[model samples]
Structure formats: structure tokens, C-alpha cells
Target: MTLPSRNIFRYKTETRQSMHSLSPFMSDDVVPGVNHSPVKAPRKVPRSPYKVLDAPALQDDFYLNLVDWSSHNVLAVGLGNCVYLWNACSSKVTKLCDLGVDDCVCSVGWAQRGTHLAVGTNNGKVQ
Candidate 1:
């Protein structure tokens, strides 16, 4: 017969002092130090991908958008079970369609007059 240890509940943290303690939103045209942070314009360097095809097995999968650039220029790549058709004006690399082996092509759209090529599958099958 020995059981008596249960009393630890202390709660008293009152901290509410803000009658505009030196501009804590007290505005009558406030600009004491001026630092709202917004004047950044000097970062332009991104132009080096006219063509760089080499997607072996390609299933990196970032929610799978799997490459697509066509307005008759054509690029559509979805690798794993094949769906490659890069033809930027006859730089040629066509193999389009092979979603076999239990399907793993993922996603590859190219039909805005590129003559239709919408293969997407991880067993979801878009074709």
C-alpha cells in the first residue's frame, strides 16, 4: 500500500503588452527604419538547352510529367517502356510506343497539332 505522486499542473503565462510598443503596427505614416524588402532584379542566365537527348530508362519520377514539347516541333519522352519521339526538325529519334512489360511509361504529352501522342502509364494507361 504505497501510491501517492500526481500533482504537476501549473499554468500562468500572461504576456500581453502591445499598445503599439514602438510601431508594432502603429501607423500614422510610419517609416522609422524602412526595410520592407523588395528591390531585387539581377538574375538572368538560363539559355542552354536547344537539344540534349539521352534518357535511358528515364524514370526519375517527380510526379511524372515526363517531358513534352510539341507544336509540331516534337519531343515527347517517357522512357522506361518507351515513348520517345524527338524530332526538332529532323534531328530524328523516333520509337514511339512500347508500353509493355506491365507498363511503366508514366507521362508524355504532345498533341497541340503535333499529330497526337499522349502516352501515360504506370498501369493507368492514357495512350
Candidate 2:
């Protein structure tokens, strides 16, 4: 959804079974830290004041549950049993993981001390 803040849009998921968070610094080689939670998400684009830098066709996977952004990349999970890491700048697809959770993610978090992440799920589990 477009926020009243203008130029700010909120993206949510459709099948929020699990949410994930990735630190921006880890990637392309290292696994980086991941956090999971219960949340259904699909690729989607809410109205934005600024021109969307990415392709317009990706508005379908709006995440409804939880998402996290580090200094670099973003992580999200849905009911698809797979985790996704997105590039914040170019709106590019980065990492995908079939964690086998196969449920819903409720929330995601970035570790303040480091580049790690934490994920929460409705199944009463944390990863």
C-alpha cells in the first residue's frame, strides 16, 4: 500500500508461512544470517510517490506477513515453503531457500549486533 508518507510503499505477502531477514553484507558466497517467521507474502508493488526502480510486473508477490531489510538485502517467506532474499536497490531476486518449514512466517528481524537475522513462525518455532 502507498503510505501517506509519500514515495513510500508497503509490500506484503499473500502466503505468509515464514519470514526471513538477511544482512546486506553477506551474500554471493556466504549464507549470511537468516531469520524466519510466520507470514504469507507475494511479490507486489504498492503505489509509490517515487518512480519504481524495478519492473512493474512484480506487483503480484506482495508480502502480507513479515519482512526485514539490512544495510543490503531483504528477506521474506510465505506459504510456498521457500525463503527469498531480495535486492533492495535493483529489486532483483537474490537468494531462495526451501527450508522445509512449509508453514507460515509471522515475523522477521535483523540482528542489531551483527549481520545475522531471526525468524518467527505461527507454528511456535523460531529459526
Candidate 3:
């Protein structure tokens, strides 16, 4: 029977000097302090200025974009087949447009300039 040859390490070995001391500073008598107290978060409360008013006939479908508020403080809402514009500053509501009975208002959006309004209908028309 032939004996198998054993692999030997053939690389040059070098030792590096550590910048920090390697002395064991930790002892069995030393105990770690506990910081198990729960952190408290700052309390935040919301304030409302006006009373709640029911917006009837407003579409509640999540997939449908039905209402939009403009930077000019104008709120445009699509109710059934009609598009109503509410001015936050003046506190007035005006009917912007009313679509035909066959088509209901699907979505309403305001221009960035706040000068124009866009309304979408179920019958595939944007006005």
C-alpha cells in the first residue's frame, strides 16, 4: 500500500502590530447597565376650523379619481353627473358644469395655474 502525500503551507508568514492594546479590560465582576426604559414620543393633536358638512351623491369608488383640490384653494368635486367648484376663500359653491344624463362625471381636476378646470365623463369625454 502506498501512503498519501500531506499538503504543507508554503507561504511566508508575517505578524502586524495592533494600534490598540490587546489586554483584557473586561472582568467577571463588572456588570453591564440596563437601558430598558421605553422611549416616549411627542404628543400630536389635530385641529379643525370648520364644521363637517355631508357631500351627498359623491362617488366613493377608490379607482375613480372624482375630486381634486387646487393650489388656489378651489375644491372641485364630481357629484353624480355634475361638477361643483367650491372656493375656500369665499366659502361659495358654484356648479361648474353638468354632463348629459347618459354620462356621469368620473373625474375632476384643476390646472396648475388654477385658471382652468378639467372634467371627465363616463362616456369617454373630457371637458
Candidate 4:
């Protein structure tokens, strides 16, 4: 047996009434009948970096976080087995420590005071 044909595309009065009731809660700026246009000011931003620092032997592993910024505006980067600290104010790069050729740095983090730095190595050593 065949089922009776039904108009699936018939206009829904209930949907229209519900939407009309919610019109008061909706923003006037987004409604179709509203004429007001919001003005947005353009933001100014530099297209390129102001300064660039060369970091050699920086690891590209996604799981390893080899760089960290301290509260004192100092950036610590782990490159190979060596850890370097770059000061943003002076633009000076200082070699903090070297784990030697036998082991490579896995991660680096700065203490809350920004005075101490923690270095993690692939050989399960923290320096």
C-alpha cells in the first residue's frame, strides 16, 4: 500500500509567531527593519616584527616547549644542549647553561620571580 501525499513545504505559522515574539529580545542593529549602522574604527598594527633574534639549533618538536618568557621581560630559549636568556630591555643574549654534547634540552621554564630558570633534558635530568 502507498502512503497519502503530504505537503512538507507548507508554511509554519507556529514558527513565524515564535520568531516574532523573540524579536523584542533581539538586537535592533542586527534586525532587518533597523536603519542604524555601527561605525568601527580601524586598528593600527605593524605588519612585521620590530626586532628579530637568531636562535640556532632550536628544536622543532611540538611536544617540547623550548622557549619561555619570564615576568621580568626576559626570554629563555633552549637550543640543542644549551640554554640562553635574552633580555627584552637591553636586547642582550646571555648563555645560561650548557648541558654538553651528550644530552639535549627538552624544555625550559622560568620561576615566578623570574630570577630562577628550570631546564629539562631528554636524559631525564633537570638543571
In order of appearance, the predictions have TM-scores of 0.25, 0.39, 0.61, 0.67
Error of 4 at 74 (Å): 0.4
Per-model CA lDDT versus the true structure? 0.78, 0.53, 0.79, 0.85
lDDT of 3 at 81: 89
Q: Considering lDDT, where higher is better, how would the candidates rank from best to worst? A: 4, 3, 1, 2
Pick the lDDT winner.
Answer: 4
- Lowest lDDT block of 10, candidate 2: 51-60
Lowest lDDT block of 10, candidate 1: 5-14
Candidate 1 lDDT tens digits, 12-73: 65576544456655664645466666999999887887667888768776899889998888
Q: Identify the superior model by TM-score, candidate 2 or candidate 4.
A: 4
Task: Provide the RMSD of all predictions against the true structure, rounded to 1 decimal.
Answer: 14.4, 26.9, 9.6, 5.5
C-alpha positional error of residue 74 in candidate 2 after TM-score superposition, expressed in Å: 3.3
User: What is candidate 4's lDDT per residue for 4-32, written digit by digit as tens?
Assistant: 64766766544433333566666534656
For model 3, which pairs clash?
Answer: none
Tell me how far candidate 1 lies from the true structure as C-alpha RMSD in angstroms: 14.4
